[model samples]
Target: MKEINREVEAILRDMIEQRVRAMISGEATSNDLLGILLETNIRESQEGGIKNAMTTEDVIDECKLFYIAGHETTTVSLTWALILLSMHPEWQERAREEVLNLFGASKPDYDGLSQLKIVTMIMHEVMRLYPPVNFTERSAAAEVKLGEVTYPPGVHFLLPHIFLHRNPETWGPNANEFNPERFAQGVAKASVHGAFLPFSGGPRVCIGQNFAMLEAKLCLARILQHFRFELSPAYAHAPYTLVTMQPQFGAQIIIRRC
Candidate 1:
């Protein structure tokens, strides 16, 4: 792990150096996240001196975080969405019909995507069944008490959202089943409050939650516009967690152009 991290840092460092040189030479202006971060750091240094600006190491750390946290989570979520949709052709047809009605074969737009009620429900249902981050952790800042138990400061708690999302008490007997209709009224009314957190709740919830949903919606919509798909006989049903929940044997599906 350390060796891999070192390699990644080396590549990021090289990229950052090139961008910094370009900015310094006035060769180009960047508006992307990296460029914006570097520009902000430069502005800070100019205004408050180097002492107040993010160091090169700090910038590298931010870049590494964006690369890891922003990439795999969404990729796996899309994978699961495709797998589930293929397994349920009725839902797949419903989603595809909605997509066709909204935008036909043209590229999906922000307004059209937002108006995708069926697609939105499908994505929400997918996340509920196969949440990318199955669990999240938190540490007690001070002593705390539950209904009957008390915990001391510094204690850690691992909250498994997958079980919560599937609990019969909150989601009824069909909790384990895939049903996008549950989300027809939206996530808040999908089940009991706090029971449907594909993105963990509270102030520190995943920052990429909205971005991830938007990205999945757009991609899924576009795919539906161009193809019809079904699960392959070679596909397996194993879901395991590495960094996030993923199909153990990979998602294999047969696709035909529309």
Candidate 2:
């Protein structure tokens, strides 16, 4: 684990340096995505950090997080949403209709996205089924007690979201099924407390949750406006969790111009 962490850190550091050089030389065309994040990290590091004074290493770490947290998770969410939408044409039509009604010929903006309740429900449902971070671990820093179990300090606990999300007791009989209507009114009205946490919960909740949702909604709306899609016969429904929950095989879909 230590070696893997080191390797990951080194790779991100190199990427950051390369991007910085590109920006400095005016070789980069845009600073919209990673270039912006890299620049922000550099500026913060130069500003002598925040309250705690972040070191160069800390800035590098933040850059790594900005990449993983900002990009990878949203990519998985979007892929799964597209796969589900393709598999269910009725739902796709409904979502596309909602997007069209809300935005029409205009591009989606922050205010327009806020009115996309159906798209929001669909995204939430996708997260429930294919949460990007499938599992997480927490180590007890001190002795702790739950309903029935007591753990000593230094004990590690694993929470597998895949199982938890599909638990019948919490989500009812249709737990394993694809039913966005379940979240039509939003998660607060859909499930028990702590039952649905695709982005985890509490103070440690994902920082980029809002950004990811907006990105997914915008991308889906754009795709729907340009194309109609359906699951290709070649698509296999096998999903696995490596670093994230992804279809073991590529998601194959049939697309026709709209």
TM-scores of the candidates in the order shown = 0.95, 0.83
Instruction: Give the number of the best model, judged by TM-score.
Output: 1
For candidate 1, write residues 1-258 as lDDT tens digits: 999989988999999999999999887767799999999888889999979899779999999788778889889999999999998999999999999999988999998888999999999999999999899888999999978999999999998989998998898999999999999999988868678887787897889888988999999998999999999999989999997899999999999998
TM-score of 2: 0.83
Quote the positional error of residue 153 for candidate 1 in Å. Answer: 3.2
Note the Cα lDDT for every prediction shown: 0.91, 0.84
lDDT leader: 1
Error of 2 at 89 (Å): 0.6
Model 2 spans > 4 angstroms off: 1-52
Q: For all candidates, what are the clash counts?
A: 0, 0
